[model samples]
Target: MFSNPFTPIFGGKPDVFFGRDKILELFELAMFERGSDERLMFITGTRGFGKTALLEQMSIRAMKKRKVIDLGPDDTVEQFITELCGYDEVVKTVSPQANLNILGVGGGVSGGSISKAKHIGREKLQPLLLDFCSKNKQGLLVTIDEIQKVSLEDVSSICNAFQMASRKGYDIMFAAAGLPYSYDKIVQHTGCSYLRRSVHEEIGLFTWDEASDALNEMFSGIKGLQIDQSYLDEINKFSYGHPYIMQLLGYHLILCINENKPKARHTVSEVELKKAEQNTLLAYQHRALKPLLDEFSGQERKYLMKMSECLDSNRLTATSDIAKALGTTQNKLSKVRETLIAHGIIAAPERGKVMFCVPYLADYVKQEAVNSSVISVARQRGV
Candidate 1:
């Protein structure tokens, strides 16, 4: 069985391991220097790059000296405040008031979900957090995961809550993690003017050596398992060191080893492992990639196809070359860059370098382009 060493190392935050040491170190430094203006550290990364795992790790670290409130994605301000105020505890601890102004259950109020979150505003939520911090009398760390899913109004309220708690001598801190664009999304949503004073951190991929070591460490923990360096190198190459892929490959290798018992000396055969990896990758591509392709428009699909063709040269393309390949103006391509980014298809790593977020999709695109060309040649011959 694949023991999932990353789970224990990351504490089941999901998609958060294999890399991100520098960011983690900086985060700890920020926490140590708590009460500074940069108490709110927003960690951002691509999908499956382990943003949640980092937050869960932080939550575990904070649990030693602070209280943790795991905020859901769609929680309203009222719901948030109630949770923050320990409403569950209050109903169980304090007066038996049956007439509490609950928003949803039994329809006690007259506001929609958005309205409900806005209702708490800065005033109501602020006091509850302040009181909680005052009573706890220890460092309070409110780590919000998937914070991007929360509405702009709610995000603003969260930023405001941090500001209010900090001003009141409350040893409170905030750590939020989300996608690469989440920081800008928060800033745009929360225009509370205080966010400008917060710190930001970006978590990126692992280096080749780091990724190799991680795979070795991960495999060594599994009982009756001993993978050779050659097999490990092949797995790393196929996975591109993506954390989720690393886990998925690890999971499948264990299954293969257990099944192919004849050749299961100490490690599984690479040939069977490759087949299993292909199957797993196909399933993932079906689930994630096909849907994204279906959502693309004719022009967008063309642009992506061009990107694949250009990137497959194993070389990066300039915007001008990308424009020529797509037969579109650079301005039009520029306009759609944000859309492609939002759709999570491609990313510009540096100012001038662009590549597919999922390299397999680029491969798929290349195959499809070849198929289309072959079909065109057949039609020409028939004519």
Candidate 2:
């Protein structure tokens, strides 16, 4: 059996990760620049827009000339410093003649050694990193994923430490990825003001051409499968340029076609395509829509349900129409609109017209509304 070529899950980098060449180039340039502000970047997008994948790719690129450190929301400054100081390269750079082990000391450095290093204060750790970077002639690339989950105090401490290193002419870079709400929170912090200068990149929808090319490439090497142009067109339209949806549709379509015939050349039919579409829709409802809706506030959810109700045949609704549906003036709804737009949930197609940024989300919202009513009725009847 031929293995599936597409990666349909979040954070899984495909063998051919397409449609991000421009951003990758920008990151590469930053990696080579010693003190460029571009080295610090903040990437924001809705869930499944490939923020984590992009960060992973950037880390891979930076590893050639710099030490790369990966941090998460729960990581503390002490843990980070201990990890950094224990690196073999950092130890060699900082104490060339000390015969230090992996823990920055001799006698085969143990867990206790790292524990002690973790207690080392910021005042001391800062100079230690500077000496290491200065001696090794290589910078450090620190990437923090899910920035929103990290506390403000930890963020401030990390930023201050990097700022101190920058002042002393040591090369250091910071890159973080998060949803728009989290990214906004980080920027709003007064102590972490240095982030204000970092380049902000918003991941947007992919072009049809990019999607088609990726699908074509994924199908090319398969021995006994050929997809029709019409099928590809349907998949592209169904996916609506969201990367995760594209993978989902492709995965389901392949399975739909290959289910009866284990190994044979086959041309996809409308029946098979429709079956795949149904499966993909169900998968998306549970995997994407339900969790996404849980993240919104009550008012935001109300506003989105109103907008979904107002969707036209073309999948777009006027802002005025949505406002009227919500029984509010457009001015009153402006902040909610802005919030949704910033989080990549919805987009303005033109003046006065708005649509869900993720394709098919409006339908999902409507389905949720129906489900909610059913639940309410069931509770009332004590069923």
User: Against the true structure, whose TM-score is highest?
Assistant: 2
What is the lDDT for 260 in model 2?
Answer: 65
Q: Which stretches of model 2 miss by more than 4 angstroms?
A: 12-16, 35-37, 87-125, 329-335, 348-353
Model 2 lDDT tens row, 241-348: 888888888788778877766556666689888998999989988998888889888878888989999889997889999888888899999998898887789889
Candidate 1, 219-266: lDDT as tens digits: 776667677888889888887877766776776666665565543236
Q: Estimated TM-score per prediction?
A: 0.80, 0.85
* For model 1, the run of ten residues with the poorest summed lDDT: 110-119
Could you report the Cα RMSD, in angstroms, for every candidate shown?
5.5, 5.2
Worst 10 residues of 2 by lDDT: 110-119
The residue pairs in collision within model 2 are none
Give candidate 1's TM-score. Answer: 0.80
Score candidate 2 by lDDT: 0.78
Q: How accurate locally is residue 129 in candidate 2, as Cα lDDT from 0 to 100?
A: 62
Model 1: lDDT of residue 36: 57
